[model samples]
Target: MKKLTILFLAMVIFSCNNQPDKGASDNNSEIASQGKIPKTEKEVGSNTTINDYSQVETEKAVEPDTIKTNDNQDINYQPADNNNTNQFEDNFIGFASFYMQFDKPKQTFILKADEDKTITCKEGTKLTVNENSFITSSGDSVTGDIEIRVKEYYKISDILLANLSTTSNRDILETGGMIYIEAFSNGEECELKKGATIEIAFPAKDKKDDMQLFSGNWESDKVNWILKETIPVDSEENAGFTFVEKMPEFPGGQQKLMDYLSKNIKYPTRAKESGIQGTVYITFIVNEDGNTEDIRVVRGVDSSLNQAAISAIEQMPKWTPGKQGGEYVKVNMNLPIRFSLGGEDFSTNNIDYAKEFEKQVNDSNLSNTEMLEISHYIFSTSKLGWINCDRFFRDNSPKVDFLVNIGTSKQVDIKIVFNTINSILTGSTSGGKYIFDNVPTGHSVTLVALKYEKDQYYLAIKKTKITREEEQVLDFEPVTMARLKAEMEKLNRI
Candidate 1:
């Protein structure tokens, strides 16, 4: 009996000795919750450091509300609350969720923090990050693995779905493209280190030489871009002269130049169908070797016409080189091409191309992608977040305020989309009304309003031309999620 008792005691002692320490188990549980584990004194030969979470105040997680459409499908819905002090804030959040539903999934890439890496997005956007280029919000250097999330907006449809607009300080902007980029290290948001710039080659179908870099500034619920600097125009190495002793001439003189343009210019089918007719002024540099280089649109009316004019000029044969003191020199030249359904041709006799070019250059209305016709927009940016390749829209039309009466004080999201320009504006509530101030008169626009109430979705869409300070009442109708999506898709076509 004594031998058996001694054996049992020995077994109990061995089991207890092999078990993990209670303090170590608790430490592991804490580390697991915090997502990182610090080395213990025994492991690092120093005291263990652990963050305290007891004093931290965390927001209560709100459960997503659901609504059943006519199709009997449950969809996540968040209604606006009028009782909230910041109605715009709530409306903006709801609008963001609504638009994000139609957006494509963001592209994600991983990189080592200690290595230089280049990530190419599926849409051909290239991002080059240098070694040790990232830091935390607290300004600490980031290490280990870094995660990059990229969202590219190239088409008008993409921009609409993302709820982005091409506007700066209430002025209009023509966009080449836009991109949203963010980085993360150890599941925490990271930023670029000081003096660190990520080289970006944002692919654009219509590259404009004057397309400038704009960084988005988020205020309230909308994003407004702020101009940074101009994108450099790619050109040959030469100190070109605006004036020369003898100007560059087209091969075989002015009449032949007109004939070349008439034969080569093919009016764009879309432009013809839409009845878009206007003149597109093209500027180019004739080098010492008599080759036309750096062709750009200094003034344009429509994208189709601008592209057509640029294409014809790009195919022109070498010109007779200009002269300065009887020696060949580079000279700047501008040509105006007319697109008319009436088949009107260019008459060189009535036009002085050089003087007209000089006057247009002095005009505040400058070159922009409003009519750009290139394959790619290349620029470098040090700032992250949302970056836009854009130019200010020059509109001299009269401006007026537009108002919408929703008839109910309930939460609503409103957007005013310009039909012709790449611009969108959010409506602000004032005196029980949603107002869009300083909108240009005599322009076509679409008004969209969205509402959610009692597990039902309500929507209103109206298209009209703003002739003056206009007021329209919106009648809300219950719509299924599918119908709402279809209606939003139509806005992208405009």
Candidate 2:
């Protein structure tokens, strides 16, 4: 009993020593869990969680900063022959920054849907990033593939870069468009180009490496490049992949205003010295015509920055303008006007192509044919005059019309009349032979000759006006050819 008690006491002592200091250990554990203690495991966690939410929190530990870049001045880089540089800041967006100046790494994503869940990304419609990643799907597809090309910093002259900064203006991070939601459908193939949605989580960075790369180019207002899929994606309801939908300035989006302010609104030197690193949030009404009619501070920056920001806001062109339903309505814009100077400088091209267009117009004239006509005066002539109509030929006077047949199947029917002293034979075949002499001396006459078909004259001669009618051509040649005229004369002449 004594030995057993001594052993038990030793065991109890060992247990007590091994036992954690209840209060201290508990507090330490709590502190450790609270992230006061930054550990490698906490910084880069192993997401072996049964639930997605827990995994997401762990993944957020290594999340990159959500810094927003400025895009307002991007107009300076607009390609020639383009007009209205992103005139309306539409949902279609474009963005640039030092990060963009950095090399854009090719990032890929693949979703392995639950199984046999049919999800199709239609041609123009895109299934973009979702808020979470619990793909409830069977047949999954590549909803959207983005190849974010980050610009390398080499161009901005390293001299100024060291002074460049990641700003306290957190708004710069707002427009990273880093999150996306794709569509998972047991429904019909989702139409592309149409706005559609399905939820996907921004996966842990390691899982992102597992994303499949597809081939081909996909130009979205939000993203670009081929998915470059290495592995086939599965489609289930919540099993699909979710990427960052935070696409850079998709044109026609309101965030552009923020992006502009984030970039252009530098911290007033005075404001900075005063320790005001925060931004001024401005919300203005952009009318349907795309002008900022009213400017109000959603959050006041200051008198100097506020007025400056307001002036800048008022100078802004018409926005796409947000809407609650289908009607144009006023919306609030939280534009953070930071006094950041190290960001990119975007300039608008002042090269006026319109001036060039004006020059081109000044050098030339354009007119549509309004009226076209050829006046005709039928002349009745004697037998001898009609026979010598060929002698009165003219070339290209408005009075002479010859170019009836241009080529091949293109043919024009012609009509004409021979004017002589006798009005009796003025008209075609029925008029028979007529006589003529000299054309009026001062003027020229063209013989309006007709090419007869099947011995029947369809219309008046379509050649030219005959002017040599002062005398007569006693030498007569049959208008219908000599042989045919001879046969007619022999058979009918009295």
Error of 1 at 446 (Å): 1.9
Candidate 1, residue 35: the lDDT equals 35
| Residue-level lDDT tens digits of model 1 in 228-325 | 75322223375455444466778876557756776678878787777677667677778888988888987787988898888887888988997757
lDDT of 2 by residue, 398-460 (tens): 231112221221111211122221011111111233322222233222232222222122122
Candidate 1, clashing residue pairs? none
- Which prediction has the highest TM-score against the true structure? 1
Question: lDDT of model 1 at residue 279?
Answer: 66
TM-score of 2: 0.18
The 10 consecutive residues of candidate 1 with the worst lDDT sum are 6-15
